[model samples]
Target: MQDTVRRILTARVYDVAEETPLDGLQRLSARLDRPVLLKREDLQPVFSFKIRGAYNRIAQLTEAELARGVICASAGNHAQGVALAAARRGTTATIVMPTTTPGIKVAAVKARGGNVVLHGDEFDQAAAHARRLEAETGAVFIHPFDDPDVIAGQGTVGLEILRQHPDPIEAVFVPIGGGGLAAGMAAIIRFLRPEAKIIGVEPVDAPTMKTALDKGEVVTLNEVGLFADGVAVRRAGDLTFALCRDLLDGIVLVDTDAICAAVKDVFDDVRAVAEPAGALALAGLKSWAADHPGSGTLIAVNSGANLNFDRLRHVAERAEIGEGAEALLAVTLKEDRDDYSRFLTLLDGRSVTEFNYRWSDVGTARFFVGVALKNGPAEKDALIARLIAAGYAVEDMSDNEAAKLHVRHMVGGRAQGLAHERVLRFAFPERPGAFLRFLASLKPAWTLTLFHYRNHGDDVGRVLAGISVRPEEQPALTEALGALGYPYVDETDNPAIRLFLDGARAGS
Candidate 1:
């Protein structure tokens, strides 16, 4: 390990980049009462810090060894780093990525002149395949963060942080996937700045390091969610696990929504988009600051910014509650139209962030409403009281994990008066007034049975709209909708939809 570290230190590829600015974040610093500094690794040449290790590790091979070329597995940022570094070193590089990896990442790898092979459905599978390819071709395996050389390369980041600040840093939050970055940073900090806290952050859905630490051994997760693909590692690397066990001060878990909120915050502050994993370190710091009150030097690594633009809306939808800026309520009315009117009136002063309603003949109609809150506990209490006064059963959806993830995607209400309904899949341009225009073209008295709209980042927006048609008015309704000249496909024949709706209704 020391030899690997020495190799890393001696590598000619090691370019001493200027230290990142540790400017105080006014909004976050004020919130946490701590001097929170953002390590702007997202501003790197590849818009990520992965290049440091990639270049360092590749530079170490002897002339004969370098002739063998190299192979590695990564979903995005790492692939770009290795590809670019290999190009600079005049060495052949091959990257294996999961088939599900985004096209943008694959394109970036190609743009950097790396031969990319799409393999497997997940990173682990792709990694395994990469190992087989390495064996077949006798290619040098550039283990992403596991090998000692890689860790040494990543440790440079810690060196830079310490040199730039030269202050009593209370904590440095580093994002963990396979524990490579965290392990490297932790080892350096533990060895040099013994008093500094090294907190490792992982997406809650993929807490490989935390799980390993809890088990007192490295344990591979059977399944991992890929929403935060940058950190959705199923298992920690062997060498990284060892370094992390010895060096890390603590491991912090941040949920997907919190990650989204942090990403949104970074984008707001610097107008730069960070992938979920990139923003995770900031999320951990914010979470830690909320619990521990202090004013000390804190650094959080902004790891990468290779996010798909299409996923922004989904992230935005969850950010409000994640940051405690909005409250989601599942409100059910006990009475008739009068009670509904009274409930709506109660929200006169509040700005409704999101409002979705579904009616049922079985009982009261349910409304999923999100309201913005200026203050935390006080606003929550007042809102609960208002719901109670208005005779509404309000179930807080703010912290309900199930509702935030699954239920929000699948569940909705039913309209009782619909004699006929037709489900249509429509693709319309996603612009400022697209939705309003669609509503304007619709005729009155035709009840909306179901509606789901999520942005896909393309000009075209996908929507599933269930239109209730009166038997006598069907012909005219279809004619009017057709005359509007929009592309539409009827999905009433889809077996999946039939089964889902039938099963849901039966269960209900």
Candidate 2:
């Protein structure tokens, strides 16, 4: 540990990296009643802290190793780091990336003079391919987080934080992917500033580090959510897991909606947009503050800004619910105009952010509505209770994933005579012909009942589809879907789908 700290102190990354600022998040601090600081690693030349480790690792390689060249596999940020680092050193680099990687990232790597090889559909597959290429070409493989040099390189961020603040910090939140950043920073913070706590943050859906710490060994996940693609690692690195297990004070797990809310919080305070993974540390900090009320100085690493522009719409839509600033409801009303007037009166002057209504039948109509909440979750629950007391049937849709991701956009009439219907939600690469390929993979005997798709400007495209199949045919249908090789969820029993599309009891 002492040698690692020494290496961090003498890390030779300044030629391609900068001392990013530790900016105060004044608005968030005031709201949370604490001193909140953000280490702006997003402001680096590559818009991420990955450059620090990448450059430091490449710079120390022997001349013969550089001559043999370098190779790596990454979905995005790390590929850019290696490409830029190798380019600066006047050496060749080959980057193996998932075919599902965003086009923006692929172009960036190519522009940085790295040879791009698109393979597989996920990081694990691409990494396997990169390893084969390394053996074949005799090139040095740059593991994103496992190596001593890379970890030491990233440790510099912790050193900078201690030097810049010069004040007693209660906790420092670092996002965990393969645990590079968290492991590096935790080692330094544990040794140099034992008084301060080092907390690692991870998406609830991809809690690789947390799981590793619990099991006391590295464990690969069967699947991980890709929304926060930058930190969607399936397993913690061996070296990184060892360091974080010994050094980190704790680990915090946050969900997607909370991550979206934190992104908005950062934007509100700094006028800078953060990708989901970039805002994960802030999300964890907020979760921690909410649970452990009293706070001192807290630091969150603003990790990266490599976001797809189209994804901003989805983030903006969910930020309100994630922050508990908005309540989504389904209220049943009579089709009469007077009932509509009465429904408006129940709102009690609160601003309505969104309103979507469709008359399912003549007797009662169900409307999907979004209302601004003045005092967050408490107010939302109170409003729901009051509405029910007033003899209106209501269902809260604020936390429903199906409602937020699909139902809100495709609320419509029930399909007539759609018997033995099964609904499935899918996520697949958004490249051209991908949808067509999926359709081709389906069995010809099944009838397509309903389909809804929207491009969120992300690498993955979300799809909601209904298929008409007899109970006996369900096994065959499942087999066909598995053959398609896309991540999916069976939404046949989703409450929102039942109310909006399947004509189940309204507001039930």
Candidate 3:
């Protein structure tokens, strides 16, 4: 640990990196009733702090090693860092990325003078292939977050924070993926600012480090959510895991919506949009503050800003809910026009962010409504209670993953005559005509009932569709789906769908 601190103090990454500013977030601080500081690593040349580690490791390589070149596997920010660092050193770099990586990232790597190799479907597969290439080509393979040099390089952020803020820091929130940044920062902060808390934040669906610490060993996750693709590693590095387990004061897990809210918060403070993984620390800090109010200087590392432009819509849609400023509810009212007016009257001037209504039967109609909340969850709860007391059948859709991701946009009348409808959630490549190709793969004999798809600007498109087929045709339906060549999950009985679409008539 001492050696790591010494190495971090002398890391030679400044040749291609900058000492990003530690700016205070006034708006957030005021809201949280504490001083909040942002370590703006997003301002780095490659728009990520990964540059610090990548450049530091590359710069120290022997001339012969440089001549042989470097190789790495990354889906996003790390690839950009390696490419930019290698370019600065006037050496060749080969970046192996998953075939599912966004085109924008691939182009960015190429623009930075790195040879791009699209291989496999995820980071693990691409990394395995990179290792094979390294053996075959005699190139040095750079592990994104595992090596000692990388950890020491990333430790510089903590060193800077201590130097930049002479005042005592109550807590330092760092985002964890494979634990590189958190390990590095925790090591330095534990030594230099022993009194300060080192908190690690991870996407709830990809809690690699948190799970490792809990289990007392690094365990690979069966699957990880890709919303925060930069920190979507299924397993933590051995070295990073060890450091984080020992040095981190605590770990916080946040969801997709919270990350989106943090992105909005950062943008509001600095007018800079942060990628989901980049805002993990801020989200954790917000969660911590809300749970345990205290007056102290809270530091959050704004790790990267490599956001895909098209994803802004999804982030914006969920931000309010994440911040407890919006509530999504499924309310049932009589089909009579007077009932609709009565429901509106009960709102009492609370602005509705969204309203989707569909008359599925003669007796009852369902409305998917998004209402603004002035006082967070308490307000949302009170509103729901009030509506329920007033004889409205309501279901809170705020925390329903399937509802938030798909059903909200697909609210409509029930499909008529589609017997034995089976709904499935599919993840397929997002390309031109991808949906049409999926439709074409199915036989015309099967009736399509429900279909909903929204592009989140990710490598894959999420689709929810229902197909009607008899029991005898199930085998053929399975074959057709297998032939479609996309990962899918059976959601035929998903409660959200049943409540909003399938059960509507039953209740009526």
lDDT of 2 by residue, 1-508 (tens): 7877888988988899999999999999999999999999999888889988898899999999999999999888889999999999988999999887877778988989999999987788889999999999999999889888899899999999999998899999999999988988998898989999999999999999999899889999988888898888888899999899889989999999999999999999999988898999999999998988876999999999888888888788888889998898878866555565566677787766655554333567677777888799999999999989888899999998898887887665575545777878888677654555666666666655555554444678777777778899999889988888899999988987787787533355
**What TM-score does candidate 1 get on C-alpha atoms?**
0.80
For candidate 1, give the lDDT: 0.77
**Each model's TM-score?**
0.80, 0.81, 0.81
lDDT per model vs. reference: 0.77, 0.86, 0.86
Model 1: per-residue Cα lDDT over 1-508, one tens digit each = 4544454445443452234555456677766666778888887777777888888888777888678888999988888888887888778999999998877788999999999999998889999999999999998888888977777777778877888888799999999999778877787777778999999998888889999999999999998889888888899988899878888888888888889889887877767788888999999988887777777788899988887788887788778777888887888875254454466568756655554554355666676666778787578878888888766788998888887776767655434454466777888665544545566566767755565655434677777777667789888778867876667888855665554543333233
Q: Positional deviation of 56 in candidate 3, in angstroms?
A: 0.6
Q: Provide the lowest-lDDT 10-residue window in model 1.
A: 499-508
- Which stretches of candidate 2 lie above 4 Å from their native place? 414-508
Task: Please give the lDDT score at residue 94 for candidate 1.
Answer: 95
